[model samples]
Target chain A: VGPGDDAAVLSTGADEQLVVTTDVLIEGTHFPSGSRSDLIGYRAIAVNLSDIAAMGAEPRFLTVALTLDQIDDEWVKGFAKGIAFCASKYGVKIVGGNIARGALSLAVTAIGVVPTGQCLLRSTARIDDDIYVTGTIGAASAAVKDGVKVPPLELNELWSRRVDDMSCRYFMPLPRVQMGVALRGLASAAIDISDGLMADLGHLTRSSGVGAEIELDRVPVWKSMDAEIAIEASDDYELLFTAPAKEAERIAEMAVRIGTDITCIGKVTAGESVAVNGEVGRIDSPKGYRHF
Target chain B: VGPGDDAAVLSTGADEQLVVTTDVLIEGTHFPSGSRSDLIGYRAIAVNLSDIAAMGAEPRFLTVALTLDQIDDEWVKGFAKGIAFCASKYGVKIVGGNIARGALSLAVTAIGVVPTGQCLLRSTARIDDDIYVTGTIGAASAAVKDGVKVPPLELNELWSRRVDDMSCRYFMPLPRVQMGVALRGLASAAIDISDGLMADLGHLTRSSGVGAEIELDRVPVWKSMDAEIAIEASDDYELLFTAPAKEAERIAEMAVRIGTDITCIGKVTAGESVAVNGEVGRIDSPKGYRHF
Candidate 1:
């Protein structure tokens, strides 16, 4: 296992294999400066878990490396609470971590397990496979653009809140762990929409040596967000996958069983390019969040 | 497995257990702000590998999360080269990681394997156990204090160089992986000296509900540096462990076989405080590095 995929899969010489993924979120770069400490903690873990989910694994453990400008008691308390909440929600354990004094940043490594020989990969998608996405997109990106602040809540209340709220979805995007696991035997290839649908789909198709054609109007946009924004925006943490057309009905049933909306956005194609359809016209280049 | 020890051990349900450790190093905090990018990268991975070594485990995989102030191709290439060198040196694989734009910082997570029943821990030391340390201590600390600059060399040249130079020790301290593996069934408790000998020993004794008494003269200090500085300074990345008093000779023989110096530094005591003897006098309080 190496760096081309969302996470690396390590054979454990057992019935199960371990999938590991790491992500770094910096204050003023990944998040707004002075954002809620708890949300920052939650988002950091959520993003890494999304990578594990994309690999069709069940997240089991997390380790966090946090750097803070100053050691404020209340801030650390809230941050810890957020991390605890997120880990508990996903049935993941906090295995290990480190804290250092520096500019604010959070680095999280999430470990998950899947059955041996069943791990999903972006390089396995075949031409003519139907491309699908779970949950709605564009909410997080819109939240970033609009500077939406998630409402502060009592720590206990976070577990009971729904993820449909726009600001909540942005600040606390849940990783589609169940959906990814469900698609393990169904989807030919999969990736989480952290880098937008188009860019991530491009990644999947390119890795599989295939192409993709997605109808923008068919995408599940969050609320009334523009289809184009939903196509180009990132951080939705939804699963973008490819499966055979014959399995579309079963996937739709799995979606209903899991209580998530699964959308068949398009189909895989030959050649090495992603074609977008609908009112936004055709985009020749992939555009999404870039660190550089 | 959680955050108190150098690394967390996870039972793999097989004969082997997995040890995971994470450490974060920030520019201007863990190293000089303008330090060599390659050295910074090497030190970051080396420190985490040291934790795995302290756990008496064979390091197998590593993941790095790096944050840079800006995108500098040459700097990134050098840093990657450093990381590659360290990982390849220890027979470990670079599995996965992430990069983002921020103040320069590196967070590394290392995974290693050990027999399930033989994993060494700090909480298992006996009162009469003899305390031991691998190789020399305080060279890295002294080098840092003296503003020593490690000489830059060809990337290929790094592989063959011995880790005896003061500046080299500071910039690229080698983790005692072989020595640690050798100590697995022999040592009762262990920890890496990242936060200085006194501080890390305090952690081990406190965890074991025991104390320690050390004659400063017995410690294997680097060259002729003041033993006090060796006892109080941090970032040596040496293994400090305790074992049955009767095993002292056997450990010494093992050290010679492994081509590394292993010194009997002290003994575990019944009381819950560390006692220092020799020219430095008895110190009532444990003194070492504190991140906060």
Candidate 2:
């Protein structure tokens, strides 16, 4: 495993293999300056988990390195709570961490495990595979664009209630853990949509040496959201994957069993680019979320 | 296997155990703001490797997350070269990494393996165990204090040449990998001296629920470097450990086999603090490197 995939896989010489991924979130870049520290912490872990999930692994351990401008007790407390909450919910353990003085930033490294040879990769999608996406997209981007304020946390709130709030979606995009594990032997290739659907799909296609054709009308955008925004905006944390068309029914059953909506919005092609057909027009190049 | 130790050890059901450690280095805090990118990269990986070595494990895989102000092609290339250089020398692979735009910083997570039940730890030192350190100390601190310029790299430089160069010691502290592996069953407790000898000794004693008495004259300070500087300054990256007094000759023989100096500096005591004695005077508190 190397840089072209969602996470790196290491053979442990056991029945299982290890999958590792790292991601960094900086204040004033990934999130606005002075945003809630807890949310920032939650987002950092969540994003890294998304990468592990994309590899069809069960996240098991995490190590955090934080760079903060000062040692604010309240901020540190909130940040730790956020990390703990996410870790506990995902059956992950915070095994190690370090803190240093600098501009506010959090770097999280997640380690996960999958049965040997069962890990998913971006370069394994086959031609004529059915392209699928989980849940609705663009809500988080819309929340960012609209400046929504994150709501207060209720520990036992229903998932439906949490997903219905745009602020929650923006600040706490849930990693599709169960769905990803379910996808292990079913999906050919998978990627989490952190850099927008079209952009990430383009990554999968390019890596697999295949092309994709999206039926724009079938994309599961958040209610009443523009399809163009759904296609171009990032930070959705949904899964975009491909499988043979014959597996569509099995995938739909798995989605129902996991309580996640799965939509067959496109098909893998034999060419080298992603094509979007329907009202939103076509894009030849990927213009994903640019950090700079 | 937790925060108090240099690295976390995870049980792998197989004959080997996994050791993981993470560290972060920011531009101004860890190094000069405009220092050489390659040196910065090398220092980041070296420091993390020191943590793994302290655990008496074979350094294996690494994941890096970088935050840069801008995507300078030359700077990135240089940084990559530096990382590759250090990684290759240690037989470690860069398994995964992420880069983002922000204030320059690098967070590296190193994963290594040790045989079952043989990992070194800071909490296992027994009273009456002889304390020892590998290689000379304080050269890196002296180089930083004197503002020495790092010399250009020569791929096949001798270990003696690199250790003799103050600038090289400051910028590229060689992780005592082989020495650590050799100490697996011989040493009772071990830690790397990144935060000065006395300070790290304090850490080891505190974790082991013991005290330590150091004979300042026995410390292997670099050349004519002040003994005070050797005890107080940071960034040595030498292994400080404890072993049964009976193992002295074996440890000496191992040192010669590994071609690294081993100096017996002190002994573990029955109490809870550290006492340093010599011409420089005695200190009771840990004043290790502070990043703020």
Error of 2 at A127 (Å): 0.7
lDDT of 2 by residue, A1-292 (tens): 1121111223244677777787888898898888777778878888888888888888888888899999999999989988888888789887777889999998888888888777778778999999999999999899888875766654335224558888778778889989889999999998899889987887788778898888889999998998877877789999888999888899999999889998999999998867788874665444442221
Error of 2 at B200 (Å): 0.9
* lDDT value, residue A244 of candidate 2: 91
* Alpha carbon lDDT at A279, candidate 2: 70
Chain B superposition TM-score per model? 0.91, 0.90
**What tens-digit string does per-residue lDDT give for candidate 2 at B1-292?**
1121111223244677677777889988898888878778878888888988988988888878889999999989888877888898899888777888999999998988888778888878999999999999999888888885776654335234567778778878989999989998999999898878877887788778898988889999999988877877799899999999999999999999989999999999998767777875666544432221
Docking category for candidate 1?
acceptable
TM-score of chain A of each: 0.91, 0.91
Task: For model 2, name the residue pairs that clash.
Answer: none
**Candidate 2 whole-model C-alpha lDDT, 0 to 1:** 0.81
Write candidate 1's Cα lDDT for B1-292 as tens digits: 1121111223244667677777788888899988878778888888888888887888888888788878899999889988888888888887776778888988888888887666677778999999999888888888888796666776556545536678777877879889888998899998888888988887888778898999899988989888887887788988899999899888989999999888888899998878888785776544432221
Error of 2 at A86 (Å): 0.4
For candidate 1, state the interface root-mean-square deviation in angstroms to 1 decimal.
8.7
TM-score of 1: 0.93
